[model samples]
Target: MKYDFDYLIVGSGFGGSVSALRLAEKGYSVGVMEMGCRWETDTLPKTSWNIRRWMWKPWVGLRGFFNIRLFRHVMVLHGNAVGGGSITYANTLLVPKDSVWRDGSWSGLEDWESVMPGHFNTAKRMLGVTENRIMGPADILLKEAAEECGRGDSFYRTQVGVFFGDEGEVQGKRYPDPYFDGQGPERNSCIGCGGCMVGCRYNAKNSLDKNYLYLAERRGAQVFEETRVINIKPLNGGEGEQGYEVTTQSSRLFGGLLRKRRWRVRGVVVSASSLGTQELLFKLRDKGSLPNISDQLGRRVRTNAESLIGVRLPGDPEMDKGIAIGSGFYLDEHTHIEATRYPRGSDAIGFLLTALARGQPGYRRIFTWLRTLLKLLLTKPLLAAPLLLPFNMARQTLIFLCMQTLEGHIDLRYQRRWYWPFSKTLQSFGPKIPTFIPQANEFAFNMARRIGGLAGSVITEVLFDIPVTAHCMGGAAMGKTAEDGVIDSRGRVFGYQNLYVCDGAMLGANLGVNPSLTITALSEHTMSHIPPKQAA
Candidate 1:
């Protein structure tokens, strides 16, 4: 059937961006709907303190990119801009260990070790991947932490998606379409301001708009920013044999008064990140638009067993001047720790970091928090002062983003509660995940002691037994059958044709590293399976 476009992709992140470019290259007409506004280099927030332009609280008149969703089990940090999480993600992009493929729902489906490298290579080239260029005092301190822990050899520079030009100098020079041979946007050298997480105002970080989406737009793929898909139904009670109808609305203030727009498409791609995709699919399933969705829709949601800890070294010269994630060290085969930072004055996130404490789950954790706070105040008042008072914490702090490959997960569902009486809010339904990883806390303490600084962590971990995760994955996982999973091995939904889920939600295992590269490679593989659009 002839339709307005051959494909309609939801969310323009690592997955949707790649899908847009590749399917357009395959001669398919594509349209992408993103819920956030397009950000350009000149318009990005200079620091996290620019609250109106740096936070994603739309109800309060802030239409920023970064979003922080609170669940019973975790606080999920994600992005909502045109480039998705890439707008706020630290540029660190590392592949997980081989054992990651041997576990999870998709295990034994194929030899992923053999299948992923070529796609990864392609993704890396397109992203302009390179070794981290500026390793400042934070990296040196991490090396010292590794040495103190007797694992010095395991420390190394991170592989990232930032462009560090020739001789690693910030020449302020422009290179014409470095990755796509004149098809993509020009880029500049990184100035090492450690602002990748806050958004790259320098055009140095290789966000999706600079590469895949840039080329896709050039190839005639239309992108609708500040728009959200409200519903998707198979055409005339048939799945893809005819086509699909997609309905979208603007998310801007008073934009709801405008009529919702409807478009017909031959196929659909669900590339929203795990949380966003799951929430949208749950609504669709309940609304009876897609009744055949698998019951395993919200199971096995993984968070890399993550822990965010840090050591604040006050008066340390030039500590916040490096790349966002410059270096990392492995404490063991399962545990990885990276030195993370934000640019000076980007202290909006500093409120989330507190004194580290060991504790069990539940109310006991609150007591542990109080006790730890008392101890820090009594023993190290000078070090604890800024953590309690207002100061430039980002400039003086060395953050450790520690992740474990150990298998642990949670389930998310939509349900109504007393506070959310009007609508079903996202909630966690499962056993309590451990709030503290002793190995991670030990590493933080050691780093603090070695540097003569104060050890810190996320306050929620101590007070409420909830861990924070930036790399939320899984949910709409792939499996061998519909009874076992929501989608099939190639991201195709079990009960539908020409429909796919190709984002972090499709990841089956705890990657123990940032999952952006994996998501991109997997989406590349998913789109490679579809034949080019036939002539109308």
Candidate 2:
């Protein structure tokens, strides 16, 4: 019954980070394996133009548009790094509506809806969650727009994970353990560098290394970087089995490729985002690594009906250069828009908004996207980006994120030499979402019109009908029984013992908003079911 490790976690994002911290805190021997390496702020790819090196193609030598991969279900950005996805996530923390709990198959298990609050509160405290007291210029404008539209006071800043200063001089102030009780590392106030997504070169952003993973390592979990898990199989699973076996190989940071080497582990938790998790599990299933996996492996892969549209004013100065996601608006009950910014002149290829268009289930939506995208590609910068640039930000730029309530999903699979099981779902996986030009375009045009000194332009996206997904989920989802559920309420795989699937894959349904908070909370909840490794 002796196992190689108490827990072998694959992927080091929110789920893996939390699991490592908790298990290590409980005094279990944990082996955390990450497909990517450590990317500190300075090392992160800078500017949208240069970001492709790190974002599009992960690993040093790998090549291709696969680095910051886009897929049908979600846009897979941020790859192999010490902090996992936290390195590039916007750091906006939000809990799912109470409805998310009551709808999924896992709804019947105990009081998940009621119970999630405690976990949420606990997570918030650990992550230093707080509302933005000092609104960025972009957010300030959004609030004004909301008020003008008769929705005053409805505008509220997002509860970001960054630690701004007390006197609002966070612009250049540095503090030691400002949030933690002096046990954490020293931190500097955010300068609103507009680079959180590419990785915070400044220690201002609250990546896992700053807290969760930080504390976990201090407790004793070993995190292995640049290690891609190839497959996970049961060592001896049954009603009372003892351990699980995991295998992986070296992962290239670039070139958009993976070389299958060999390694092993006693237990495994798949925290490799949605696309990564789905592709890995599919290999386990199709390649026969873990055949007992449920037939519902790739169902309900959701896009959150997400869309991205920005309103910015280029060359106005003071543009972008602020917090990543400064403000969000509830355009209607189901639709929401956030005031987003990026360092001005970033990826200065010139197009402004990347508004998504959605249609009912199929190639029809793709058709709509093609027509709009062609216009975006052939258009001129003055012909495009400037119009989206808000008046105040016209010298710079303004961006809006247009997301909706429609629910769309996809599946991942495994194939041989040319199958692209990973490539198809991972590479070509450009956010295979819907198109909404008429509405989105109209909104963009009008917004530009309202605030302008001759604003005009268009929206665009990757050719061949691809989109981007930041918060990826599903591959293994929840269902009534082993027949459908990938794992039980405790997140343990239905038929396998000592094996569990955490990460976004466990997200049984859509949250219709940022899912980091929900994923972290679920991982925290799953920790309760993990029976302490019995005493020797």
TM-scores of the models, in the given order? 0.97, 0.85
- Alpha-carbon shift of residue 482 in model 2 (angstroms): 2.1
Q: List residue ranges in candidate 1 displaced over 4 A.
A: none
Cα RMSDs, all models: 1.4, 4.6
Q: Which ten residues in a row have the lowest lDDT in candidate 2?
A: 453-462
Over the stretch 1-536, how does candidate 1's per-residue lDDT look in tens digits?
A: 56898899999999999999999999999999998989999999998889899888777788999989988899999999998899999988887888889999989877899999999999899888889868888998888878888899999999999987778455556776677777777888888888899999988899999998998999999999989899989999976567789999988877855958999998999988999899999898889898889999999999999989888877755668888999999999889999999998888898888887766667877787778789888988888877764368878898899889999999998778886698886789797777777888888887788778888888888777889999999999989998878988788998888889989999988998999999998998898889887785
Deviation in Å, model 1, residue 337 alpha carbon: 0.2
Candidate 2 regions exceeding 4 Å error are 51-53, 56-66, 72-78, 168-170, 236-240, 253-266, 312-314, 348-395, 415-432, 437-441, 453-466
Separately for all candidates shown, the number of backbone clashes (residues 3 or more apart, or on different chains) is: 0, 58
In model 1, the Cα lDDT at residue 464 comes to 74
Relative to the true structure, how large is the alpha-carbon lDDT of every model?
0.88, 0.66
